[model samples]
Structures are given as C-alpha cells and as structure tokens.
Target: MLDGQASDLRVFALGTDRAGGMATAAQILGGAGTGPGEFQRPTALSVGRDGLVGVFESTGRVHLFGRSREGELEHRTTFQFRMDIEDGCILGHHLVVTGLHSEHSGVVHLFSTAGEWVRSFGRFYDTDNPWVSETIERSLVTCLEGSDEILVAPLFLPEARKYDVLGNLLWWTEFDGLRPIYLAETADGMVGVGTPEDGYHGTIGVTGDVDGGIAILQVGFITRERRESGSDPEISTYVLAADTGEGALLGRDFGRIRDIDGKGAVLSRGVPFPTLRVITWPPSVRQP
Candidate 1:
C-alpha cells in the first residue's frame, strides 16, 4: 500500500502470513521532503524490469527505486513529466503515462528514464473545445503482458485502444453498453469527475491489464428503480479481451483491481482505511 503522509511519504510491501491473514508492511521507498528520495502526493506505482519500482505523483513527479548491493531498496533517480498523469507503467528505461497531453493532442505520453521527453501518441478524438477533449480523454494506461504494446481506456467512455510503443494504434473497440463515469461530491454538488457530468453517475474504473486483457471494476444500476432510489449499484470486475473488448466476468464486489503482476492481481478494498489483497488469475469462476 501507499503511505500518503506528508511527513512520511513512502510505499510499503505487504507480506501476508501462510493462512492469508493480516498483512505486515515493509518500507520500500521514499521519505519526507522535496529531495530526490522523498515523495509528494504519490498516486501510482509501477514495477519495471530488473526489479525497479516507480512511484508517480499526479503532479508529474516520478521516483524510481531499485535494489542496492546490500539488497535494500534504494532510490535510483527522479524525473519530471509534463502532463496531468493519471496512470503509468515503466518499460525498460522509459515510462509511459496516461492522462492529458503535455503539449499535444494525445493521451499517451512517453518519457525516458533520464528525463528526456519521448514521443506522445494515441489521440482519441478531435474537437475545437479543449475542455471537451480533455474530459473525454481522461484515461488510464497499462502495458500488455509479454509485449511492448500498451492499452489505454478513457474513464468515461466505453472504448479502449491498443498501441505499440512507437505510437502506432493497433486496434480500438467499444464495449457495448459500458459508458462508465466516476461520481464524487464536490463543492458544486455531485459531479461525474471522470466525464464532468453534473450529477451522480455510474462508475467504471480500469485497473490495468491482466492475462493479456484489460481488467476493469465497474458499478452500475441493474434497474431504474435502484438508480432512482439511490440504492447501491452492482459492483463487478471483468477481464475484457484486448482486441475485441469481449471477455468473462471475474467476480462482483471483490474490490478494485489495482495492478496485475506475476504474483497476481493486486486489489484494494474498504474505505477510509483500505486493505490490499492479491488474487490469482483465471480465478476458477467466470460469470456469464
């Protein structure tokens, strides 16, 4: 889990007992300050090749940690991105982030480990209004397993796009009936922050890729009555195939899948204080 404390910013590795009970935290990276090893408002985590871990902040700061000769996690470097990053993944010596374009008309932006700006691509739509394009392109990006390809999905749209590292769009498909919006209560009242709608809306959040597909957690009303009454919507997780946007349901109300690695799918559940768990893939049951 991430420690967002202003005085003690860091990431911890949770180790579970044999019985899969409570977890113990081990400090992996970070401290407290604007210095190289410290963090500020860290938002996302990415595991790269060679046991390197990346800690990202929404403000475009990134801190990379790697093991030292003494077998301890040491802060290797820090870099700055030029976008309002939402999610990202580290590929070899570069990092790929998703959100708004730093200075162009794309959603996916790439940067080198040494802070060099790489090419940005994956333009979703075109419009003269910057607000419309930015709201519609609020996206999350993840790298496909065993390949250099990446998949990007907008938080409010039912569409997903796959692209190669060279900024080539391979395929794009829309998930039928799956327009998900993120709702939050702001000073202006309830708002769909994901798409900027003016009221309470359904939610569909993409966690990342698992088993060569996109894993998403979504909440939706099954009936108009439930929606009208403000009843809790059904929560479900699904692994949709990368190319076709078709796949099987993994489970319902099982927590938000955060990132999938070789160990499994990392999930965060509960509120106020969250608990993290890892569930194996091909999870033994597939809902129709």
Candidate 2:
C-alpha cells in the first residue's frame, strides 16, 4: 500500500488452486508477484496508462489486458518479442515499450493507438555503438501528459538516453555516482529524475536542462525509517512537485501497516502497527 493506500497494479488468475490459466469463474490474482511468462516466465506486471494490464512474460511478450468501456477485463493484445522483455507505457493513444535482449541487443518498440506495432528507435541494438554495444539496453520509458517524447531511462547503464516520439535518441548523459530511482518528463520540456542519498534520510533528486545543462531543484530525503524503525513516533504528510524527479530526495521507505479495509482511507496510528507507508520523492525537514 502507498501512504496507506494500495497500488492498482494487480495480478489475477483463472483458477484458484494452482498456477495456470483462467478457469470458467476466473480469479484476479494480485500483489507484488510474478510467475512464468512465454519462456523466461512472468517477472513483472503494470497497469499501463491505457488501463491495459501489461504483463512481462519471459518469452518476450508485453501481454496487454484491459477492460473495455463496457467494464469487461480481458486480453487486449500481445506485443511479440524477438529477444527481450517488451516493457511498455501507454499514453492516450500512443504506447511505448522497450525490447531488451541481452547486453548487446535491445531497442525501443513503438505501437499505435489501434494496437498495431509500429517501428523501433536507435540503431537496432548494434554491438559497436560506444554508449551501447551488443549489450541491448532496455530503456525505461515515461510519457508526460503534454509532450510527445518519451523519457527513456536506461537500465543504469554507463550513459543515459532519451527518445523522441519518432524513436530518436535525444540526449545521452553520464553521471558519476548518481543512480536513478525515479524518472519522468515534466511539462517544462525537461526530464525529472530521483536518486537516493545516504544520510539522515534518503534524498530525492530533480534536474532540468537549461543552456544545455541540468538545473537542480529541491534535494530532499525520506525520513520514515527514522520513525518506523524507532520506538513509538508520530508522523507528518509530504509535499512534492506536481511532477516527480525535480530535485533529488530520498525515496520513501515504509514498514508494514495493518487495519485498513477495502476501498481505503487515511491512517495515522493503529494497534499491532505494521509498516504501511505511501512513498514519494523529497524528504521533509519539517516535523509534524
């Protein structure tokens, strides 16, 4: 649960007893879980912007499932894979996914609103590229509401890359010790990133491009560990930018939380308190 709320990402199945396809009645499995895919097995799942259930099956298919306007949930389509996990994001009409094969064979897979697979970006995962080699870099993509470009966050490779809507690499940056935890595109024509800083709290980082350089916003840290890991403690809420990855702050860490029922509501304290926190960027210096 995030901030005592549950993420919509869910997993479901058709049968109740075993790991298999759906039975007649069908069961919706959920929580942070994974199973077998086509070949490599099911590793991850997400609710794409299009509300389609995107599943990363091992055989290289970003399985798409969604409920139509009629409120029926079913398989929408399947994005095939030559040799990679086809991770994807769906904007209003555009869907962008990554096809990662190995250390030297990956590319960006683009799809249209009609569920038709389109073209790909980059040099088709060449092995000779300096920033990329045979090492196929499966880029992490984030689509901002207003922009056409997809902010591509590579898999912590030596260099970072961003791609436009037409599948062109826009920028490739290299940071010394900065490992990215959050990535998104902002309305200001810049990419937002969050990184962790080890100190009193976790740090959140954000930077925007200006004069061909990055401008840092607020740097904050997550302090939940201070309270959750300690004795009885009070808590405070958090405030972040309308978008994330503006300045670096520690990501929020939470312990278990108990006593919340279905649907949901705000919770401050509870008996037999477990860790339940909705994490975000920018730690707070102000006390509650």
The top-ranked prediction according to TM-score is: 1
Stretches off by above 4 angstroms in model 1 are: 5-20, 179-234, 248-250, 261-263, 280-288
lDDT of 2 by residue, 71-157 (tens): 666555666555555345555566666665433324666667565666766653334443333233544444443345554544434
lDDT of 2 at 9: 33
Q: The CA-based lDDT of model 2 is what?
A: 0.42
User: How far is 42's C-alpha from truth in model 1 (Å)?
Assistant: 1.6
Compute the lDDT of residue 261 as modeled in candidate 1.
Answer: 53
lDDT score of residue 204 within candidate 1: 44
**C-alpha lDDT (0 to 100) for residue 61 of candidate 2:** 53
What's the TM-score of every candidate structure? 0.76, 0.46
Model 1 per-residue lDDT tens digits across residues 227-252: 56655446656676666656666778
Superposition TM-score, candidate 1 onto the true structure: 0.76
